[model samples]
Target chain A: MTATTDQTATAATSAKLSPYKRFTPTRGNFELWSWVFMRASGILLLVLVFGHLFVNLMLGEGIHAIDFAFVAGKWSSPFWQVWDMLMLWLGMLHGFNGVRTIINDYTEREGTRWVLKTLLVVATVFTIVLGTLVIFTFDPCIDPNSTLSVCTK
Target chain B: MTATATQPSSDEQKAGAVPTFTVTLKVQRYNPEVDEAPHFETYEVTAHATDRVLDALHQIKWEQDGSLTFRRSCAHGVCGSDAMRINGKNRLACKTLIKDVNPDKPITVEPIKGLPLEKDLVVDMEPFFDAYREIQPFLITNGHEPTRERIQSQADRDRFDDTTKCILCAACTTSCPVFWNDGQYFGPAAIVNAHRFIFDSRDDGGSQRLEILNDKEGVWRCRTTFNCTDACPRGIQVTKAIQEVKRALLTSRF
Candidate 1:
């Protein structure tokens, strides 16, 4: 018997849906892992972000204590350098993934999504790379006539 | 008709007379045969405070305009039909009273969004049903049927009791802004129905159903706006169900 109704059958109506193939673990679970990462990284980020903010903005001498020498001193140590690096990486990635999801949610056109996501990636890479470089390659003896301890040594 | 002309005052109500008032229903009208775009048409009907929005629709259809079209089967909220947007909220017309939704201004009545509109207040439900069918909403067992009925404990039944109340009304699904933006995503109703079966202890196909929902257009598309939960007439915690499914996917536990 012909399966026809009074109204015209649309594309979604006419097409026969393919059988559902059960997803195996062999297939990559990018979305699932990303979901987990968002939660896990969020918790870790809370500690890193607040710690960074407290040290820079609310610590010993507060905001005014933040100067070139202060930044140089902090980055001079491996622990602080690693801390800054982790903060930069996690913050950028978390924010990037959030924007990606926003783009996916709002943008309908494939071409538009591609362009926006490309820009997002480029901006994220630039920020993360530049931030990491500044964290590790930061110099304490940039000024030639500096009298700071590291500069003197 | 003026509002005061038919309105029974409090004194009249105290004398065992039902209070009546003129209610203007601003219904969205669209006929693909005639109109290019959907537009609103207002009809004033005399209604009691206890009158349902469905009752207003009936009065408008029967008395004012014979062409006003909508769906209503049970006339009570049981059949899940007559789910429409009343005052910009997805609700069953039969379940909503005239006074419940402020009747001072014109009550706006429209079809649920995110579905293909067939006519006035009627949408093509094939796609909605397709998503439901994709989830395979029946109880699936691994082995053949036994002679006796498959036994299920009260606790096991209670695990999925909340999701079992879904009436397939499309209220939750259509209220979702994500589904409105993208029709490809399996809407909340489909996911809710899937949750009903997935958490069933008797069903052996939870993993398979979970895998189906694990698609990009599946549970991941849910932004947890809680519009689905708010729109559910049966009070099903739709967003919570989706979250439960997401957690199940992560831990591979039911």
Candidate 2:
């Protein structure tokens, strides 16, 4: 009985001495939605990616058809423009979330994780913004003597 | 004594004619009282091919060195007292047969990782048990206790049958790379225990356990490495249990 009592006392003392660090309940379902989004976006990306590839590389003239002129002609239409935009956004977000999960898995220290994640956010944002601008602002006829039908019209 | 030039060939050994073979057991030992750092000590023992690793350890401790230390209670796999890193993998020494591991080469033995080593092949199990207790691994139901037992359907019991086999062996937890790096993560064993209670249809405290595991150091830390599943001596699919908990968390939140 005395040994049992001593053991209980020791357990109580250690429990008090080393309290578990309490993390406040996160405010929202960020991780849950992040988990869901990865799956949903992945499915959508498959169709958009394959369709884009088929149109550019297989539908008409195959690999030889892919050039600046082909790209410029495709981006001229709003249908292809929206398709490309969705692809860009979904692809970037999917890849970024994957890298974030990897970072969280490997990095142990708080400061190191913070530094790596900050760099990741910056890189992701820059690429997405630049890609979106190019998809929307692309023009094959910037030159004054351009011969393209869209520029002449 | 070393084996002579006339040692039995493979066919004779397989036919049960060979009485014994010499095995070199290289054990990583650390004593807080004497050692500055852990080191390996080699011992050669004559043993039948079918003898368990625990038996070899016993021969060394009983005859070779009086101070050599390790923990074993039932000396069977049930008690889970002798979980160790045998040959660079987490396994219960009592369950691993000598022949299963290549005894011709030196079989390495060491204490499980991610815990404070107390002495030779023994670690302080307080942290592991503390995590177990933190999950409130007990039936918590609301209202007055039923005079009769809380009845559960056969299907309901089957839902959690896989997780109930966990012996609280630290093998799965210690094998995890995440647990090796961060002590706070509620390693696979704790999650497996939580799963046992969580999926029980009779338990009402699942949401509470889910909330606790929903913390940053909870189920999200699992990288789906499957090391825990491979290390489990009880054949528990540890990674599947963890994924189930992760899915439960997602469904509960939304």
Candidate 3:
């Protein structure tokens, strides 16, 4: 244990209101990992999300041209497929981690934390699985009943 | 000695009122020289609604037990020395009013968390100060000093004005559960102090501060739990400052 010292004890000291109590973790670097994730994901999300938005909203004809064809046209290429897949994974992970922090901060009771984080994980997993499948496996041409140009070609 | 405690300062003395109620202070006492663990010692002090918890401790230390040890220099809320867990909440005893808390129950006072309890309410502040020093809590100026003064805009100064009010009392840091769990994490006070200079347009050292806080146990370790914000004696937007530092780190790379 480091030694304690006093500096100018005659001077005035500050006072403040009480903060809420929390249980401190005795081990692990989970907090460090979470912190790094926020920054890394934040930076990546800026690029990935802004790129996604620009392509969808600002590129040729803007929102008016967007349809099943617009989405299929982009996803058919390997480059856009990788971009959208990265966006989905990073966005979902980043958002869920952020919410997990909120859950830990506000939820006092174990039951609240347990149930909410559990639901968050379930929702996150389901979305990620469903979203990834739709991104990679989605082929308009495979749906034989479709009459769209991209589907036929 | 069943001493009648002295009345509060004239400014604090309520007019046309009688101070009659008794406040029982359950103080934690420990002496590493003799005692194995700290124990609670209760003292009933004569007080009023306007009286702060610090007044009761003074009464006990003065007339009841001079052996009772706690650190308090400024009886007011400036020094940040009297921070303790008063009634299970971290507060500056000088600023905490007895009436604000339930006076009916015995108010429990313990040393602040995340530091070694040396004796009564005193804790080892070395680690706290170490983290403060590690952050390089000072202005770094690479430019030549002007003959008169380094000119700065009022807008530039105001950008970091909130963090400039920190008293470094460790109330915000000690209150952080993160610091309590892992002392390595730069607690709110250190980050708040770093923010004071990092956002200052006049300061040329923010890049270094940004780099230092980007460590594994640095700003990233902050969980945005708001414990430091709530516990800040100066009412600084501590969590917000930490966030600002985080943004600076992320944007500095670009």
Top of the candidates by DockQ: 1
- The candidate 2 chain B region of ten consecutive residues with least summed lDDT is B1-10
| Segments in model 2 whose C-alpha atoms lie over 4 Å from true places | A1-28, B1-18
User: Individual DockQ of the candidates?
Assistant: 0.29, 0.21, 0.09
Interface RMSD of each: 5.8, 3.5, 8.3
Q: What is the lDDT, from 0 to 100, of the residue B13 in candidate 1? A: 45
lDDT tens digits, residue span A57-88, model 1: 99899999998889888887899999989989
For residues B24-141, could you state the per-residue lDDT of candidate 2 as single tens digits?
Answer: 9999988866899999999999988679999999999998987889999988899899999999999999999999999989999999998877799998787788778889999999
| Model 2 collision count | 0
Question: Chain B of candidate 1 versus the native chain B: what TM-score?
Answer: 0.93
Per candidate, the number of residue pairs that clash is 0, 0, 9
True contacts kept of 1: 0.23
> Please, what is the whole-model Cα lDDT of each candidate in the order they appear?
0.87, 0.87, 0.81
Native contacts recovered, in order, as a fraction for each? 0.23, 0.10, 0.07
Per-residue lDDT of B127 in model 3: 71
TM-score of 3: 0.65
lDDT of 2 at A52: 88
